[model samples]
Target: MSTGFIILALITIAGAIGAMNCGRLVHCALSLVASFAGLAGIYLQLNVWFVGVAQILVYVGAVAILIVVALLVTRNAESDRQNEGSKGWIAGGSVALLVFILLAGALSNTAVTGAATLAPDSSVETIGRRMMTLYVIPLEALALLLTAALLGAVVIALGGPKPGRASK
Candidate 1:
């Protein structure tokens, strides 16, 4: 592996660990962003330009920022953390180990078949055209869905009726 790939992998692993172990929601969100960015860099290094850019744009740009903003707006992150006292680490670890063993056994029994490769036909333009023409409705629906979700988050954060407002 290249030095750049090794660096990116290390960053990704560190960020993932921080995201999972950090006590504060804001710190965890920031660590998740670091992990997303490092994965994007690794994708770019692997020459998958579209996926890398999409990772950076959609994950790092949109999702992580939205999470941070939502956490800030709610302003109850610490209180929730206090409420969630014990995290049952032993049970979680045991389940994870069980799943890993099952997956390893399954993979060990699977046969690898080598197939002839086909020429590359997917370009950025083709993907863009497909998105604009074939999948526009789904795309617009997803945008509307995300907008509704954002509005819902804001409403929840506001804690219902305000002091000067009347409820119907």
Candidate 2:
């Protein structure tokens, strides 16, 4: 409703689109960082300062950098291959349309049904406690997934030998 929210929404949408449609992996990662920052701005506008800070720190700082680094380490730097696989555009457009329709429906049907709200004393400590106690398993799974991705990238970048010449 506020100007800040409107600006942040625009930034988020533009950055997300740029990230999705970028030809270069590094550019996509940078656009992701922009999108994360925009989301953080929205969190701040909603008065969740801790969430905003954590979003910026975790997403823009660590995850985005890690994505760029992984792409650089595993992919050929000189290659300019765009994502032009068969049915790529159709799949992407279908997903986008589905997301738009779902979001529109959800927003139209949303109601303010909450009775209890967070107290003024609520801090990052409460969030941390809840995450550690109730969300620990999912957090651990995400960490494990990231670890596996890192290991896979390392293997792809450093473990392979060059293919031999084919015999005629």
Candidate 3:
């Protein structure tokens, strides 16, 4: 593996660990941003520029912002710690172990194959054209969806309309 790839992978892993283990939800969301950034770097290093851009746009920009907004909007002054017991840890560990075993088995059985590779410039241009033409509807729909989500988050943050107040 390349040194850049190794570094990106470490960033991804460390961010994921920090996100999982952080005590505060906002810190976890920030760590998730780092993880998403590392994944974007990995995609860029692999020469899939569109996917890398989408990774940054979707995960880092939209999702992480949404998470932080939700956390902030719903947070309480009281400590949010939960007293998780040993059984919870044991169950979580077992589930993680099972998932790891399943993933390892699937990866070990997969075969790598060579596929046709295109120039990055031409690929990006083709993608852009398609996005403007064939995929325009879906892209617009996604934008609308994100807008609605943001509006909903704002409404939630404002605790919805007052129960007994008249309309302005």
Each candidate's lDDT (Cα)? 0.86, 0.85, 0.87
* Candidate 1, superposed: residue stretches over 4 Å from native: 1-7, 73-87, 112-122, 159-168
lDDT winner:
3
By lDDT: ranked, best first: 3, 1, 2
User: Top model by TM-score, which number?
Assistant: 3
Which regions of candidate 3 fall more than 4 Å away from where they truly are? Answer: 115-124, 151-168
**Residue 151 accuracy (lDDT) in model 2:** 97
Candidate 2 C-alpha lDDT tens digits along 40-155: 99988777889889899999899888888778777974655555775988988999899999999998899958665664554779878977999999999999999999999889
Tell me how far the alpha carbon of residue 133 in candidate 2 is from the true structure, in angstroms, after superposition.
Answer: 7.7
- Candidate 3 yields a Cα-based lDDT of 0.87
1-168 per-residue lDDT for model 1 (tens digits): 579989999999999989987877788999999999999999887667888899999999999988988888778635546544456767787998999999999999999685645534456998889889999999999999999998998899679787667654
- Model 2 clash number: 0
Candidate 2 local distance difference test against the native: 0.85
Cα-based lDDT at residue 3, candidate 1: 97
Q: Superposing every Cα of model 2 onto the true structure, what RMSD results?
A: 5.4
The deviation in Å at residue 138 for candidate 1 is 2.8
Which model is ahead, 2 or 3, in terms of lDDT?
A: 3
lDDT by residue (1-168, candidate 3, tens digit) is 689999999999999998987877778899999999999999998888889999999999988998887787788876455455779768998999999999999988999675757645647789889989999999999999989988997788678667678575
